[model samples]
Target chain A: MLTLFYILSAITLGTAFLTILSKNPIHSAIYLVLCFFSIAGHYLMFNAQFLFIVHIIVYSGAIMILMLFTIMLMNLNKADEKNKPILSRIAAVVAFCLVALVLLATFIKSQPVINEYKVSGQDFQSIKVLGQVLLNNYMVPFEFASVLLLVSMIGAVLLSKKEHINN
Target chain B: MDQAIIIEKGIFIVVIFAITMLFAMYETLAERKIAAWFQDRVGPNRAGKGGILQPLADGLKLFSKEEFFPNTENRFLFIAGPAISMTTALMTSAVIPWGDKLTLFGRDVILQATDINIGMLYVFGVLSVGVYGIMIGGWASNNKFSLMGAMRASSQMISYEVAMGLAIICLVMMTGTLSLGEIAAGQHGWRWNVLYQPVGFIIFLVCSFAETNRTPFDLAECEAELIGGYHTEYSSMKMGFYLFAEYASMFISSTILAVLYFGAYNYPGMDWVESVAGANIANIIGIFVLFAKICFFIFFYMWVRWTIPRFRYDQLMKLGWKMLIPLAIANIIVTGIIILLADQNL
Candidate 1:
């Protein structure tokens, strides 16, 4: 199980690096998809099958497709993108280092303890249990999320609509 | 896991893979033969014995054809597209319960590849990924028509999938299970979900047609407009893979439809047969019966293809968003009400 975790983590990090390193936009998108898939693999390794499938469905399936479509629509396949200015490049490097340092500092400060694994007989992550929890306990948050989504969808539709002109 | 159990799983996977490929192969022939019959023309009878060996011949031809690649910047994605499609198509069968269980060689064997709790969700996830295949392929082709086809396919599939998921929610409510095996088991001896949720079934059927890009919802591959659609730039075995993946998906979807709504591997006299002929023999017949239902659905797909003209893109979207989505939602609401009412009464 540890070996599987290491392998999945490796895959996830490798593809994530490739997603940025790849020159072509399409290649980057595909690599991003691979990265998402690997993350889903990690979820599966943790035995969170429901989360794994949902993650794949939402990220790799829908969001990535939308990203790819936008990329293709923009015809950004050519390697004609200008390199960042030297100042911007240096700033980006500094920003990356800062973020990494902060993340490392946070991790070190937390002093997280690993709990001994215990097998729970309850099927907590199954659809039925999840559904009950969502509807009963997290009902308000769930409904708020749906409302937010609906508002966004309506906004998108309204923005995309062509104006009617009377002659 | 025990070595014997591992071996059994390995064998099961191999068998399922082989069956998927075989069914996909014959589906091509069946499509051709059925199309010919509809058009009053004899199909390819030249290969061997009413062209029974036609798919083999077709495979050979595709294999021998010159490998052709269009001028494209993303060669990797072009190749990955069909591979993804084929893989996802085959992956769906993993959760499908082909039969109940068979007693073989002093051991009980489950016919399904895996009996995961989230079988329906897994299928939906894999199917949603199928859009990437067409999208990547079309984009990699560096052709406008192909890109347009891919765009249409992605949008159409996404829209219809909403309806499909909603329709399935009705079934999930009815069965009170997401596991395909459990759903199939619930449909014992003619208590099929289709009988209970006819509206949901029809919505699901339509959404499936759209999802699979069959005729009437095949705006992505309108030959007159898109010029071979997303596969316009592919040739030889790569193109064959895309086509094969479509038929494989069709077969899988048919199997899903059967297992979900049509009482998979369950007939009226199944209990009687089991009592008389024993568990092993009964399950063997059950497997055959399941396949028969799958074949009928496959035929129904082809039948609808030949009978209906392709829908205009707007009409397709309208049907998906306006018609099917509302219907599916209504079905869900109605199902929920009935269930609540029944619970209250009980």
Candidate 2:
């Protein structure tokens, strides 16, 4: 089990790094897909079949298609990507450090929660249990998330809609 | 996993793979034979007395053909495209319950590769990923027509998937389960989901046509506009792979339709047969029944392909988004209300 987890972790991290390092945008997008698939593998490793399927469908299937479509349409040229200015590079590094520090602090603060965790032999990862939790305990948040998605969907439709004028 | 179970599954997978490949190969001959029948012409009759060996002949021809590669920007992706397509097409069969269990040497063996709890979702996920094969192949070819074909394929698939999913949601609501095995079991003895959810069935059927790039929805590869579509630059067995993948997906989708809506491995009087002939004989008959239903759907696919004309790109999109999506959504609402009322009455 540990070996499988390590292999999946290696694939996820390796593909993620390759996504950034790849010169071609299409190659990067493909690497990102591999990264998403590896994450789905991790979800499956946890025996969270529902989560794993949903992750694959949403990320590797839907989102990556859209991303690939955009990358394909852009007709990107590697020569066009000039090196970043020193000031912007420094700023990027600083922002990255700040984000890392915040993440580290959050992890440190949640150490007790992690320590308290136990493998209670309960069927929490099944679809039934997940659905009940989402609809009951996290009902409001879930509904809000749906609303946010709806708003974005409507916004996309409106943005793409054409207006006609008779002058 | 037990050693015996591992061996069982390994053997099962291999059998399933062979069946899928064989069915796909024959589906080509079937398509041609059916098309010729519709056209009132004689099909290939040279190979093995009535063209029974035509698929083998075709396969051999494809294998022996020159491996032509155009000067493309990405040779690797060009090669990977058809490979991905074939892999994803075959992957869906793993989750399908071909038949009920059979007893071999006093051990009960399930007829599916894996009866995952989310088998239906697994099929859908794999299907959605199928777009990458065409898109990569098209883009890597660096041809305008191929790229256009790929674009149409992606957009059409993405659009139709929404309605297909909504249509399936209605079935899921009625069945109250996502596993194909459970769903098949639920529809025992002619209590098919199609009887309850005809609207969803029609919507799903239309979407499957689109998803499989059949007939009216095959604008992605329409010869008039895009030449050979995404496989324009492909040759030899590589081109054959794309065609084979299409037929394989057609077969898989037919199996899914039978399993989901039609009574999968279930016929009226099956209980009587089980009681009379014993479980083993009845289940074996059940397998034949399922295959019979799948064959009917496959025939339906060919019939529609030869009969109807391909849709215009805009018409395809509008039909997907406007017609199918709203109808599917309404079907879901009505199904939900019915279930709620039934529960209330209970």
Candidate 3:
């Protein structure tokens, strides 16, 4: 299990890096899809099958496809993004190093904790259990999310609608 | 897992893969033969007796054809498109319950690849990914026509999928299970879900027709408009992969429709048959029965393809978004009310 976790995490990190490093927007989108898939693989490794499927469906299937469509529609295939100014690049590097230092400092400070995993015998992540939790506990938030989505959809339709001019 | 179990699973996977390929191969021939019969003509009688070996000849011809790649920038994605399509097309068969368990060597063997708890959702997820195949292929081709076709295909699929999900929600509510095996098991004897959820079944059927890009909803590849559509630039085996993947998906969709709405492997007097003819024989019969249902669906696909003309793009969108989606939602609401009333009566 540990070995599988390491392998999946490596894949996830590798694809995530590639997603940004790829020049073409299409390639970046494909890499992002691969990254999402590897994350889904990680979910599967943790025995969260419902989350794994939902993650793949929402991320790799729907969201990535939409991203790809937008990329293709905009014809964003050229590797012509302008390089950042030297001062901004230097600042970016400094910021990255600062974040790395802070992360390392936190890791060192928390090093005494044992990294053992306890397997929960309960099928807490199963669809039935998840549905119960969502309906009973997270019902309001879930309904809000749905409402938010509906509003956005209506907003999109309204924005896309053409106006008529009377002669 | 034990070696024997591993070997059993390996054999099952191989058998399923082989059957999918074989059915896809013959579906091409069947499509031609059926089309010819409908047109009052003999189809491909030159390749062996009654064109039984036509698919083989076609395969050989396709293999020998030149592998032509267009002057496109994203070659990797161009190749990945058909590969993704073919892979996803074959993957959906894994969750389908081919038959009841067959007893062998003092052990019972379930005739399915893997009975995942979320079988239906898995199928839906994989199917949604199938859009990428066309989208990538068309985009990588750098052809405006191909891109347009891909756009239409993706949008149509996305639109129809909403209605399809709503339709399936009704089924899921009725069966109270996400597992296809459990659903099939619930439909014992002739107690098919279609008898109860007729509107849901119709909605699902229509959405499936749209989802599979068949006639009346095949706006993606309307040759009259898009010039062969998303596969306009593909040639040789690449083109063959796209076409074969369509047939494979068709076969898989038919199997899904059969397993979901139809009786799956169930038949009249199946229990009696099992009692009289022995479990093994009865299960074998059940497998054949499932294939028969699948074949009927395949034939139905072709029948519709030849009979119905392709829908205009606007009409397709209107049907998907306006007609099917509302109907599916209505079906779900009615199903929920009926279930609640039934519970109250009980």
Task: List residue ranges in candidate 1 displaced over 4 A.
Answer: A77-121, A162-167
Per-residue lDDT over B1-346 for candidate 1, one digit per residue giving the tens place of the 0 to 100 score: 4898889989999999999999999999999999999999999899999999999999999999999888876788889889988898999988999998988888888888889999999999999999998998888888999999999998999898889999999898878888999999999987988899899889989989988989878888899999999999999999999999999999999999999989998988889998998988888998999999999999999999998888888888888888888888888899999999999999
Checking candidate 1 for backbone clashes, the offending pairs are: none
Residue A164's lDDT in candidate 1 = 29
lDDT of 2 by residue, A72-119 (tens): 887888877889999999999999999999999998887552122235
Q: Estimate, for each residue in B35-108, the C-alpha lDDT of model 3 and write its tens digit.
A: 99999999889989999999999999999999988998778889988998899999999999999999988878
lDDT (CA) per prediction = 0.89, 0.92, 0.90
Question: Sorted on TM-score, highest at the top, how do the candidates line up?
Answer: 2, 1, 3
TM-score of chain A of 2: 0.79
Q: Candidate 3: where are CA atoms >4 Å away?
A: A77-121, A162-167
Winner on lDDT between 1 and 2 is 2
Return the TM-score for each candidate structure.
Answer: 0.92, 0.95, 0.92
Tens digits of per-residue lDDT for model 2, B80-136: 999999999999999899899999899999999998999999988999899999999
Q: What is residue B332's positional error in candidate 1, in angstroms? A: 0.9
Output per-candidate TM-scores for chain A, rounded to 2 decimals.
0.73, 0.79, 0.72
Chain B, candidate 2: TM-score: 0.99
Q: List, residue by residue over A54-141, the lDDT tens digit for candidate 3.
A: 9989998898999888988888535756778999999999999999999999988884312221244556767987798789979999
